[model samples]
Target: MPGSLARFRACFERSPRTVVLFVVIVIALYVGIRDIAGDAIIETLDSHYPANEPLRDILRTARNYHRHPVEPPYKDKFWEVGQRSRNLSRWLAELNGPWGSQLRGFEKERLGTAIETTATSLFPFLSPPPPKQGSKTPLRDLQRSFTKDSRGIVIPAGGSDLQIRFAGHLIASLREVFGCSLPIQIAYAGDSDLPKERRDALLSFDKTNNTEFLDVWTVFDDATLRLRRKGWAIKAFAALASRFEHVIVLDADAVFLQSPEVLFQQRAYVENGAYLFHDRLLWQHSFEDRHEWWKDQIKEPSPAMNKSLVWTEDYAEECDSGVVVLDKSRTEIFVGLLHIAWQNTWAVRDEVSYKITYGDKETWWLGLELAGSKYEFEEHYGSIVGWEKEGSPDDKAVCSFVIAHTDEKDKLLWYNGSLLKNKLVDPNGYEVPLYWMMDGKWEKGGKKDMSCMVGETRRRLTGEEISILQHSIEAALRVDEVIASMKES
Candidate 1:
């Protein structure tokens, strides 16, 4: 017995995994598991530990307390002693020992506390202590522990093959056209979202060989956050989950006029550690409920609340999340991400968030507000890009589908809605987009999915500006060719 105890102490010191097997074996045969399945246990540890093990499973199990469950064992009142009892039983079953019979006569309710304590001590990797409720420190610590010291572009791809095509354009623009060498991470929810073939196609976009793929499920345990299969929510989570300390989150269809690296050097981003752009300021009060909800949620108001269009102008939206930049090293930003994560969770979206805001756009700023974090939005409102209508009542009246945004200098920085002639109506005609409304008014009572411009002022692209647009269009066309090659071979 003394010899067994010594072996147990030694194995426990080496790894908690051994303690689990050692405890179970001791319970069953009153001896060491090292004597029965010693090599098997060692091999299991070798196969899984001190390497790139998929931590999602371990993390999910670790967080599986009675109060919070990855998957509830019973249909009713899941937050009870029964859950821990079930966890204890399931963990022991993996041992494939006679311990089940040993535990058969033990009172389940009485065993719950002991089982949890013993299991957590024996398998610390599989049973981490629950996070402190309503605290930013825990999330800050988690982010600090997980994040790496790097900067990169992160795009949440994978709803359909169409996203793959769009990502191809964006990646090509960054690498081939704008000449950005920053690393890129193509984040997807799971294997089903981005299959092996599509990932292989993305790998061909960057010749400098800095791009890689990240599974959102693998970034953090799904028990903590099971993202919706599709929607704007994925972008925020992708930005949060990325290994890069500083991340530029881009929509798959986003097109840039400049190398995005320049934004990192902006004074606002340098000061606040977060940067965002304004959505089209549609003058409508249709989102009173959302505003009220925000007021209730964010108790201690910050300067952002006073300056926001949501409160001041009664605008329905404030952020166009086509582009988002964040530095997770900031405790406020990391905590703000946690708030955004809760806001975008499957239940919250279906119940409140989506009904309140347009999509995931407003949640970004609102979440930051809720966490008392600071972020900077561009000084200019959203602008329009594309050609003027052939026959318009006003000479400068423009009817274009592209929603453009500007930099701090009020110059045309980038735009969403793609590079097609008319992304909504006709996609085949790739034209050199001209005419923009820097300070134009959004004509009210417009039809759905249309940007009707009413301002007499329009800014035509300079020769240099036209050249930049042309370069992005060519890069997109080149990506189309690559996709064609992929389909063929």
Candidate 2:
């Protein structure tokens, strides 16, 4: 090798023109390889970490032609890897039909910035004084653990009725994942919200822990805001009315798969003061209904649509409003999103205000686009474990770290839902290697063709693990009964 190198050097020295040509060829080859590798890696990350716009905007925002006003880029390899596997599922599902009732809404509601500017412009003259929201916190008992600047979690239970039913699991998971590192609160809406007994049941998760509840009407009784049906108006109210200075607005269905402490530490939150996750589905195809709800809400087109950021072919999901973390620093941005939601679509006959079914999310997306908010949660991508489908011989459900959920929050819900239909088949509880989120994608198992992300064998929880999973939900339910029986006695 040394002699060959010396000979090559001598030949190069002997012919200056030949050496220059060789150098040019080498440089060209390097650029070609670099471009290919960059594209492949980026595509992988984009397709999987569709929500990871904040992270992807590292150079794009500062230097790209299109401005990305969101958070910094994500550097976590494992998270990106896990997101990719789940993302692949999202893309595959996108290829499938929206199914039955979901087929009605195929287009996303688009609001031009010009329309929003016109609607909000009337706020001063037409709107009543914003609800009198003071810092008088309801969860004063937990004040000892939190401070004026501390962040907290807010789970909204609109008339959905599922939040309370799943309270035990949510609390248990929060405890296991967050360990009371931050204060927690529940904001419920609807005249027929939670009964006193159920509310008490939720607080019973921890004898030492106490949570705050909101009547919602106290903050969002405005006639203009009444158009919102999902009580998201209440959530919009909590964005400003809540006691905590910073809050992580979480959907009840956004069960804690793991600790979300990292969310608070993001550049969007730390630097820009605002952050939100990307919606998994965007564009006209992701919408579940065909109703043209925007016509009545605003008099004009949405001006912000022109500059809005969109998902690339690499990423599948774009915006998920279900989970968000924002501080007072970013309240303006949050409010921007709220305004659009409030002003969009007037109630049709028999329809609630905001007449739109998913007006909250639609508004949230529009508001961000209008404000050009840079902080986004999609950059910190993650997924839940479940089963998935594959071809013929490998058609059976495979227990893997899948991205599946029946909830609308799920990006690949349709696809994952279908695959998970077979269920994680394990009666006795076998020990398949655990699907490690930190490991990103699943581990390979020799050459065995498993239909999972890593393309290996399927895995299932042991009886103990299954029991534990079931127990969390059961425990919450049992506690409700225990307290009721004790009171009766």
Candidate 3:
């Protein structure tokens, strides 16, 4: 202990390289041991079994929500298989080194089981097996809804480049699937360069097909247009439309999973004035006391309804504009209300204006309330889900529309998967499904033969598709790394 500093200085000076090597060895040993221990813990957790009854109940409930008919007795088996497959897949993804080689086998077995279980459960829902003979009857029926003599318009608000591309993809998908010759009217609103590219893409498609592309700049005067944003412009156009039965003000990123004609059957519902929204599973807790802006407008509940003031008893439903389907009358009323609500207020962003003035969630609630309009709430299961990272459950059973919001790129995988599977109950035609790329193989069986469809259409990725996916994954990882590093820093 005597002269410890002097003694330590002497030892380091004599064996600096040896000391550095010793430190490296210790660090490596610690990391290796930690990795081993972590794997063991995860493995142990995976081995633990939950009681069967509760597990099956959860699976049965989820299945029921998607309109799938499942026998009560088989519910336990369904849950067990799903849980086991998910666990093994996750565990295998976590393993490292020589021991990790075993993961390949586990992943294949579990993934296959998961697919089989999901497919089997989904099969009955397919109704009459896919028509062996292609029926032009359905297509003809869809066409007659809107007179060939009549014209229709779809005004999508384009904000970002991704938004424009998404709108293009939706239009392309619709055209390919339906073979509908309806003259599509597209209006893109944004900065000169981005909108030009967007308009070009849409125009390119229109040139080959029969459609009209209207650039917002061409339609609007300099002063009037400058006062409004892209989203507002689209809404305004929808408000002004005269003869269109259904004026769809879709956010640029919302994609059409099924034929747009499914909406036409209910055309008269929204004809006079009806608001269509993707139904959100309202958690009473989430809306508790969250909306403050509407507090002054509505009577405050006893406990402030959890924390948001916007939660009013009048409307338990909330609408997301990502995909709004409304006829001309409803469009006129909503647009007029929105204009008056924001006229004198310091206009923040579109979503913000709604939130600040009426409490974001309550804007639609208030609009519907004031309009004295009865909304025909149609549940298009696929229309809206928060993005993957947004942690909305993969309610594939209920999803009819895949709304690509803040993150457009991730939704590409979902869209591709749906298209390739031909999952939509389209009266038109089926497109190829895309998720078979995950395992580089596919199997056939279960509902809709999604497995077979995925496998048959699966092809070795060309240099470009592989490159795009790889780049996307890497970019996402880099973003996560930056976020984590910032947190640590």
Candidate with best TM-score: 1
Higher-scoring candidate on TM-score, 1 or 2: 1
Per residue, candidate 2 scores C-alpha lDDT tens digits across 77-154 of 212222222222222233232422232232111111112222223221122234543323221222222346767777
- Give a tens-digit lDDT track for model 1, residues 150-248: 889998888776688889888888888778999999998778888888898888888888999987766445553456444577787788778888889
TM-score of each: 0.70, 0.50, 0.40
Write down the RMSD of candidate 3 (Cα, Å).
29.1
Scanning candidate 3 in windows of ten residues, the lowest lDDT window is 381-390
Ranking by TM-score: 1, 2, 3
- The candidate that achieves the highest lDDT relative to the unseen native structure: 1
For residues 35-119, could you state the per-residue lDDT of candidate 3 as single tens digits? Answer: 4443333333333432233233333343333333333333122223223323322322333234335445644343333333343
Ten contiguous residues with the weakest lDDT in model 1: 73-82
* CA lDDT of every candidate: 0.67, 0.42, 0.37
Deviation in angstroms for 195 in model 3? 4.7
